[model samples]
Target: MIEVEHLSKRYGSAPAIKDVTFSVEKGEILGFLGPNGAGKTTTMRILTGYLPATSGTARIAGFDVHEDSMAVRKHIGYLPETPPLYPDMTVEGFLHFVARIKGVAAGDRANRVQSAIQRCNLQERRQTLIRKLSKGFRQRVGIAQAIVHDPPAIILDEPTVGLDPRQIIEVRNLIKSLAGEHTIILSTHILPEVSMTCNRVAIINRGEVVATNTPEELLQQLTEGTGYELEVEGNIVNLTTYLQRLAGVRGVEQLSNQYLPEHRHKLRISLEPGQDLGRNIAAIVVKSGLGLYEMRRVQASLEDVFLELTTEEKPIDAEKTIHTEPAVDSASPASDSVVEAAQTTPTTSPTLVPESTHPSGGEDA
Candidate 1:
């Protein structure tokens, strides 16, 4: 568990993190998301005791990060943006050294080192020098070193950044397997990674936490009355035009690629958030005599939430037409409250809403 209160960090004159506060729950995977220079790495550094905060307080499992840094470090395993490694050392040698420095008991050091190697699947490369290993192997080496001591929490900063797709998947599965046994804070800009690995996410923009909740809660917060995509065999007697006139129907997109020539129109319909447009849209297609091939809800994802939070409010694109049936009277604000944080200070992120927070559009329900 972790807690930050009124945390801020300044570099000379400008702040890198400011008045940022949040908690990382036990056994939960918390995704730390933000654009470049979002202070994600900076915050992690402070929590890991790699860097000291400019102001405020931070606590790890009830130990003050500033006062009891060594105690805090004893319970946290951190893999930074780059894994610290010795190019000439073999995997087994490196892990053994890490276990010693982390204070593993002399009698248990061999078991601890072996456990890390097995968990990271480095058996084949145990004798290979780190500099001679592949990028994926190097990443695994970093992770193995971090976990060699079996710390209670793991901080992986961009663990999949340079890996190929398959390598990324491997690391992802590895991280997922570590959860429940180790609390993790996975920091990355890749939305798909968070969706796959984390239970909860905190969208950090301009150095502040703009949004925080379970991945599903965050998606559901933006999906109410979003849209539906339907692929069908027929335009069928003007059904598309008629569906446009139905209540809560905002807009329709017709896909016109050469790949689908049989009946040709694939409709992507936008509707009032929270409205049941699928059943209504289906009825129109049936009544108009069109053959429906596939229909499903198009939920707004984590990317949509990140952009909406990080990007400042701007004028709508002029070429795009705005369509809407009506605003749902059931709309609710984004979160529970904006209470004063009780922990450490952090630097501010560059791209975000103004200092005075604005109400978010959808309800989590």
Candidate 2:
């Protein structure tokens, strides 16, 4: 429901975002990821009409963000990095004011305000002044305001920042629930947020989009530093040396030697991406007379793609070298679904290859 083409923004001689482009599908939660100074907030501001782009076209639900500014604003709800809240206003009063400003019908204003308050779990604090609420509660109030009008799309910048773990989970669940009803462009640096909450992700770096795809598809793009972890019961002191010498094996690092019985050891095995080393490693362990208690294939994650994309010094062209992986065998679930995105050992860090445009757009510094 969003589109951006060749979007760019500059301040003085330096560019904040250059040729930034990306799109978000209807009813999708797209994580807009980038490091500091990578222009994420700049892009969001432009799309929300708070800032203008130097040059480019941005459309929201077919409405031109620039030419149809009012129309676009009507269809979108935006929460800036720092929530704009009236500390003196009570929660109910604030939401009622927001509903009016967002143009909710007079007859429906009460319902909309109540729905927002309920959805954000602000019932207990609806009578409390915003200034009296904790940071987490205030954040919920900000989100409640954004959705009070029930817009078609929502642009959230760091929705979970400053929240405690419990608060973060509450907000995360709330965001997930909003999908299908409201298209969301979630801009944040928290990798796990993208992995757990978003259907797809866009990584921007050096004022440009470097990658865009589903989290799983992007993880498959890693060409190195993919492998497994093993817990074995053995006494071999030279296992690391042997594993390293094996074909396709990149490196072996012993993580721990602790065991009550003193026969078990845990080690991490690094391999080239897409390498089928599981059977070989298992066989080697058997031949070495070690009991393989567990072996779980490591999977790449959004963080891996983010670090690879943003850490690079050069700009990446999203049009080329970014494609989804073909059908491949899925890794067996031997461990938690949480991907350990540790840097690949003994291999060059993987490079991010972007494919589609994510409509992050652009804005001035």
Candidate 3:
């Protein structure tokens, strides 16, 4: 299990993350969903004990990340945005090296390395050199090294940054498969990753946690319920006025008629939460002498929820009061310094620092 409370981080005078709070239950995959420069990586680094928070605390498997950094490191596995690898080492050799550095006993090193190789599906390439492998396989090698020590918790920051669609799906499936056995915190800007892979999501914006809940619960709580789209043929001058007056109807808009036939109009109806007016709408259209040609339901999507929460300036009234703050450009020097410090930190001791913390030295996702 993982717990974070009021975890704040700052670089000089500017704040990177403020009052951030969330938790992950055992065997659950939590998606830390946010845009670039939203302090996702900052939080991940602090939780992994690679960086210390300005205030508050983080605990993994009941050990404090700051006060008990060594114990926390032993209990969790970490993968930075770029996979840290030895270009000359074979896949099996690399995992074995990582296992030994992670304190795996000499007797258990072989079994742990094999298990990591099998779980990451790198059998054929086990003997291949890391530099010779494709980017996708290299990513699998990254994950294999993370699990090689058999830690109870794993932290991944942007695991599928540059992979193609097929590779992304493969990596996604691999992360999903590790859910029950290991608690995971997947940090990503990709929307589909959260809805498809995580059981719960925490949406962060402007250095603050905006909302936290399951995908379905957040959609239902923050958005207007389902609506309808209809195509009708009639003399419909006051159709919108009538529809707007109907109970449970929130609003109605006439769509573009550019492609529609003459005298045929397309309309979209917005509905209040928990309201179903399909039967009433049909009956009213018939009574009004309009020939209803088509009617279809439109459900709210995760994209809709994400846009609404991030783009708005006012707080949304819901189970979790949406937090709002002045927008801070993610590319500012303040944020860059924190990232630079994490990347440039020494890795003299593998147990104290994750393997090759800044292998690629690329910008944060």
RMSD of 1: 13.1
Per-model C-alpha lDDT, please? 0.77, 0.79, 0.81
How do the residues 90-140 of candidate 1 rate in per-residue lDDT, one tens digit apiece?
Answer: 999999999999999999999999999999999999999999999999999
After TM-score superposition, what is the CA distance of residue 298 in candidate 2 from its true location, in Å?
2.8
Index of the highest-TM-score prediction: 3
User: Tens-digit lDDT track for model 2 on 1-365?
Assistant: 99989999877667888998899999999999887678888889999998888999999999999999999999999998889999999999999999998899999999999999999999999999999999889899999999999998999999999999999999999999999999999998899999999999988887889888898888777434477778888764544444555767777766645442577877777776556666666766665567888888776666667777777554443222212231222342311111111112233434322111334333323
Model 1 lDDT, full chain set = 0.77
TM-score of each: 0.78, 0.77, 0.83
Could you tell me how far off, in angstroms, the CA of residue 191 lies in candidate 2 after the best superposition? 0.7
Clashes of 2: 6
Clashes per model (N, Cα, C within 3 A): 25, 6, 0
Model 2 is weakest, by summed lDDT over 10 consecutive residues, at 334-343
Best candidate per lDDT, number? 3
Error of 1 at 142 (Å): 0.5
